[model samples]
Target: MSLSPSTFETIVPSRYITFTFPNHHHHHHHHLRVAVLDSPSAATAAASTAAIWVPPGRESDWIFSTFSGHLQLLLTQPLSRLILIGNSPSSPQPISYNSSLHPSSPTPLQRNLAPLLSALTPKSAFLDDGEIPEVPLLVFEDEVVKSSIVEICEGPCVGEMLIENVELENDGVKEFRRRLRFKRMPNFVQSQMRICPKNVTSFENLDNMKFELDRGVLVQPYLNPMVAGISVISRFLEGRTFRPKALCLGVGGGALLGFLRVQLNFEVVGVEEDEVVLEVAKRYFGLEDDELIHLFAEDGIEYVQNLAKNLSEECRFDAIMVDLDSSDVSVGACAPPTEFVRKSVLLAVRAILHEEGVVVTNTIPSSKLLYERLICEFREVFEELYEIDAGNGENFVLIATKSKVRNALEANEGAFLNKLKSVVSGSYIDSIRKIPRTADPAF
Candidate 1:
């Protein structure tokens, strides 16, 4: 069962999980049992299996169950009351509740569950139990894990460092900020990045930037699915040049630009309206200006219109990506804003693309009506449209092409994945494979 991202903030049916434990306040000995319900159907059927008892020694076995796998993630949630099913065949009562539930006082269940909760608490094998300090670690890919708050933009965009083994002195921290580069990262830090635990210097023999890009590493997890355009375009690029051309609408942190340029060897042109974001990208995100990389500080919609008018077919981009967000999200248009999704603007964007080129947009619609409206607008310009739900129930990545070749992409799926594997590590592709993917909505 899937848990909603905002499960704790609101109490909606099938959104929250229920935990059950046998009443232990009495002296009667009984088998320990754990029940977890993640959906409405499961909650309705929980009573039948609520009293299923396990042997005394088998309690540890339940920790490996499907529900246990998500328990660690639960620790980060603002949980409400947990239903405690007593041994008596009566309705359960809330033994304890979170602050959000306006809890009254502790109950007997807290005493019984204390040991089980302690066992479930995550513990580091290398670090001691004593108070560990949070140190500013190095930057991996684009994120500055658990480090001091470094403001990248005036908006909510920022970076912080993750805790690691080595503690840096003030001079070291200053030096890191000066270079804005570090090659070594601890095992735990690597784990936090969801990468294999290894000395980052292992790739010292090769270009470090290429190494990360080849592995398909992106700063934001949602962007991974957004770049599925690479695979879409690969199937039809039989006679095209090995290095494709890409147009990036938003260059926040320059992660997508760097990924496109280094991974696919694309000649990338990045456009960002905010000059401060460009400077921050250069200063903090290691965005370097080179012959293959072009940076423009202008409005994305106007740039697309100008390019459509002046750019030659030979200079057209193979892929156009939109990842910008509106400053005022109260209107519910977050990514690409309302202007970028306009039919006229989208047609202009399509005019400056290769015949086989694809347009991928990152959209975060505030309401169902807005999302449907966005899709209808997209359907007006492109003949074939594919969508990938960012898996967070919030962000969505839409891939649109002028031609009808969805079947071709499916037939070449094996080849496409193989081609990607040749460029990136197999494990990296496997990790991104978990991203929820959906076909066209039949618009």
Candidate 2:
């Protein structure tokens, strides 16, 4: 039953559906043309997925296989509309396929796409019309292609690496070993990755990881809010502007570091525990440790402790950003590992910070108790504490300051917006608008 690759025809019966939805300003309409293929084969899926849109550039192959499976399912059942959204709106939408309905039958997709788009499109005036729409298309003839399920990256990757580890529980030590892949899917212009566990055999296990866009673009929504938190520090140092120094504890891909050094005119010190990650960052993510940016391969907590013990005016940082997250899934809180947030560590961090310095950390609290506990722990050391809700509900950026930033949010709101205007470009400014209007719950 062996079949030649050439025996399969790549062409599938594809139906093109064209619809118009009002643009964000409602001044014009955006014509969305989706090609619906009937019963796409593996070759067609791969070709279509690669050609139409990429869910995550690094995991492009896996997404294609998964997409192929769903398309196969469409042969038997009526599935919802498949909407593959790219990170940016201007990025092309992936092709959708529907086989259950006749071409003349007006499916739910045609009926509801407009209303759904209107509701999901962000109301923010600053966001480009290209930003990812926040809604979903209705059910189509067969199969549901989830919206916003994958991370987008700028690509045409040149190199890739697969790091594998095996788990064997022994000697009172257990390793949660799986697969870790480092894909240098670079635009030569930009960078990103695709990682997943070796144990991930099905769609269920694949839930743990996704593709990531590297330093060139802040593909992660939370990163924008994280950058916005720095505006509080910038506003605090206004008029007395000296070259600000920033310390980044967990420099994953060095995206924040690149942003700080190249975009914001700041000297950055990045400390990453994983040497492999550091190398990947340099080789794949465009992280370079030049005069303006210094990279350290060491323990973040110990580094802070050493900085505290050898405290010097020259070593003090204007802003300290802790972006640590635990690899151990069993650990409830994902950011800062429990040790980084300890009172002693916080004190050491404060010791190495300039008087007007600010500390920002990305925290994903697994429980209500942990979240309240973190807020309480931070309030004890810093005179001012604020939270930038990333809107995802689970992720938050905690901004803590040494000096009492009286009404920091209200006082610096305008300044923060103005600062964003100066620092970020149009394509990325949507992140600024992503900042919750009611951010900085505490004054």
Candidate 3:
């Protein structure tokens, strides 16, 4: 809808319409721009050349033109992949304008478009079959089309669309091409920082990912459900008489460790097996190496087994927060060596967990209506279990506690949620406060 100040103008087909046009009432401002490239090298300086922003639903809106006069770009459909040729759309004739042609002359442009018109041309590597190029496209409120062009999401990926590739004269003038790449603004994280009013939500996206990756800052990335779940865990630990000692399984971005270490001042130890995960958490998410926050790289199951065997009653932990999702082999703690998930692994965890301590876990169920086997087993182990519906999808934050929460259980859902708001921190605190009364299909 809006272009940045740095941009000056767009070349549109004569038939195309834009609000800036005199008859603004007939069309809206949302526009689609297309570019054709002769070669990678020729694509440079695309901005100076004219471009048009095509408004949807008008035939006159899409008029391919002779821009740059060097390259002709053809599109059979609305551009998922491009078939580039050196010949003009008007004629099927071959034009081989080699490197010797100067910019002022039309020879170079004609040459690039001429030879490669056929798919079988040797030089036509640009039009390779089975090549799915990640392209940039904008889909705002207004659009008139069945579905849309391939690949457009605000986050979790990045790409650029190439419009022009300049193939210089035979002597090799500086090669150039024009590409449009878009960066996703961290609006969700930034806006949260401004309004959340709590330091916990200020984890990975606390700053731009580029900056966080640069500094390797130890902050949790803002996962909506994960954030709320962590807050609920923190609230549960708030009432402990002793300083809470927390164990985090599967260091997801190391956000939980950061929160427990800085926000709750808990004696924290984070266990993660994947070397790449720890490396990325440290390098990109700013996971810190400090005395208060310790990280161990080993198989989560073996580590727990070792802890259960070695530690005495005095060494039990106040809270164990398990967030191992990616696999279903073992839900409570990463794939729980199949033998352990049956009972031993959980019993081992319970052995080291203090009598009044709590275990909080994030489990992705097989179905929203179906309860997971691990949580079902957890009910068999712990005396009191509370389930919080994350409201995102099938994410369930199950709280299994050693101490009885009669007060919380006695109070109706509304009263319990009111108590939760008072106990937890951040906007997400409210989201996880929604505790489910009954299991949809108790396994």
Q: Pick the candidate with the highest TM-score.
A: 1
lDDT of 3 at 314: 50
- lDDT by residue for model 2 over 1-443, one digit each (tens)? 43333322233333222233333432354433222333322322322221122232212232222333233323323322233321223323222222222233443334445544333222331136555433334332211222122232322222333322222234644322222232331111122222223434543222343333333345444666677777666566565546789999987667789888876778999997767667767755567989999999888999999989998898999889888765432232256578887999999999999888889888877566777778777877887776676775557788888886554555334543576656543432333222222343321
Off by over 4 Å in 2: 1-216, 411-417, 422-443
The TM-score of candidate 1 is: 0.52
Which ranges in model 3 have alpha carbons more than 4 Å from their true place? 1-242, 326-340, 368-372, 409-443
**What ranking emerges by TM-score with the best candidate at the front?**
1, 2, 3
Q: Candidate 1, overall lDDT?
A: 0.50
What digit string (tens of lDDT, one per residue) describes model 3 on residues 1-443?
A: 85342222222221122222122222443222233332232322322222222222221111222221112221112221232121122222111122222232333323333321222111222335845222222211121121111112222222211111112222433222111112111101111011111324332221221111212121122333343443433434555575667788777456667756655567788887766556545643457878777888876767888998998765678778776543321121122234445578888878788776677776655444335566567767777666566554445666676655544433324432454344344554543343333553222
TM-score of each: 0.52, 0.51, 0.45
Worst 10 residues of 1 by lDDT: 182-191
Tens-place lDDT digits, model 1, residues 256-291? 787777776778999987676677667555677898
Residue 45's lDDT in candidate 3: 30
Q: Best candidate per lDDT, number? A: 2
